[model samples]
Target: MREVSSDCRVAWFLGLAGLIPFVAGGVIAWWGSSAWQVTAVYGFSYYSAVILSFLGGVHWGSALQVPRPDNRRRLFIAMVPSLIAWPALLFNVVTGLWVLLAGFILIGGYDLSRDGREGFPAWYFKLRGLLTGVVVAFHLIVLLRLGG
Candidate 1:
C-alpha cells in the first residue's frame, strides 16, 4: 500500500463525517417514535438525493478536465445520477427510497468502474467505494424498517 497523504486524510475525514446523517437516520428509523420515524425517514431520503446529486457533480467535474468533444458523452453520463435522484423525490416515501437506492447502486458502479482511470486518485475511488457501501447499507436498513 502507498503512504497515506494529507489529501487522503482530509477526504477520509469528510467522507466519514458525511455518513453521520445516514447513521442517525437509520438508527432513528429503527427505534424512534412514530412521528420521529417519519421525520428521520424523510430527512434520510432528502439527504440521499442531495448526496446523489453531489456524486453526479463530481463526475461533471471530471468531465470538464478533458477536451470538449471527447467529454460530451462523459458529461451526459455524469448527469445520470441527478436525473435519477430528482424524480425519486416525487414518489411515495417507500418508492422514493427504492429509487434512491438504485441511484446509489448505479453511481457506485460507475465510480468503481472508473477506478484508476480518468485521473481520479486511487484513494478517492476507494473512499467512494467505502462510503457508497455504507450509504447503501443504511438505505437497506431503513427500507427494511419501513417494510418497503
Candidate 2:
C-alpha cells in the first residue's frame, strides 16, 4: 500500500470540502428556491473546486518534488476551465450543467486512473469521487427537470 503523505491529506481535505457548496446548491434547486440563493450556493461550490484543483496540483507537484513555478502553472491550466464554467452555469443552467458534467468526467476519471498512486488514503479518494458523482447526477436531474 502507498503511504499517505501530508500533501495528499491536504488534497483530500480540499476535495472533500467541495461537497458543501454542491449539496447546498442541489438542495436549494430541488426545493424550488430562489435563483439568487441557488446561484450563491453554487458560487461557493465553484470556488471550492478552484481551491481543490489548486490544492490537488500542489499535492501532486510536491509529491513529484518539482519547482513552485512548474507546479502552479500546471495547476492553473488544469483548474481554469472549471473556474470559468461554474460561474457561467450560475447564469445559465444549461451551460453550467455542461461544464459541471465535463468536470465530473475529468475529475472522476483522473481519480480512478491514479487511485493508489496519489499518496492519499484510499477511502478519502473513494468518498470524494462518490460524492462528486452524486452531486453531478443531482444537478443533471435538475437540469433535465428544468427542461434544459
Best by TM-score: 1
Per residue, candidate 1 scores C-alpha lDDT tens digits across 1-148 of 8788898899899999999999999999999999999999999999999999999888788877765554777788789989989999999989999999999999888777743147587778778989999999999999999998
In candidate 2, which residue pairs clash? 89-96
- Residues 58-140, candidate 2: write the lDDT tens digits: 34554456444355544554465456554754655566666656665665565565432344556666666666676677667
Lowest lDDT sum, 10 consecutive residues, model 1, at 110-119
Q: What's the TM-score of each model vs. the native? A: 0.92, 0.57
How large is the C-alpha RMSD of every model relative to the true structure?
A: 1.8, 5.3
Candidate 1 wrongly placed segments (more than 4 Å): 114-116
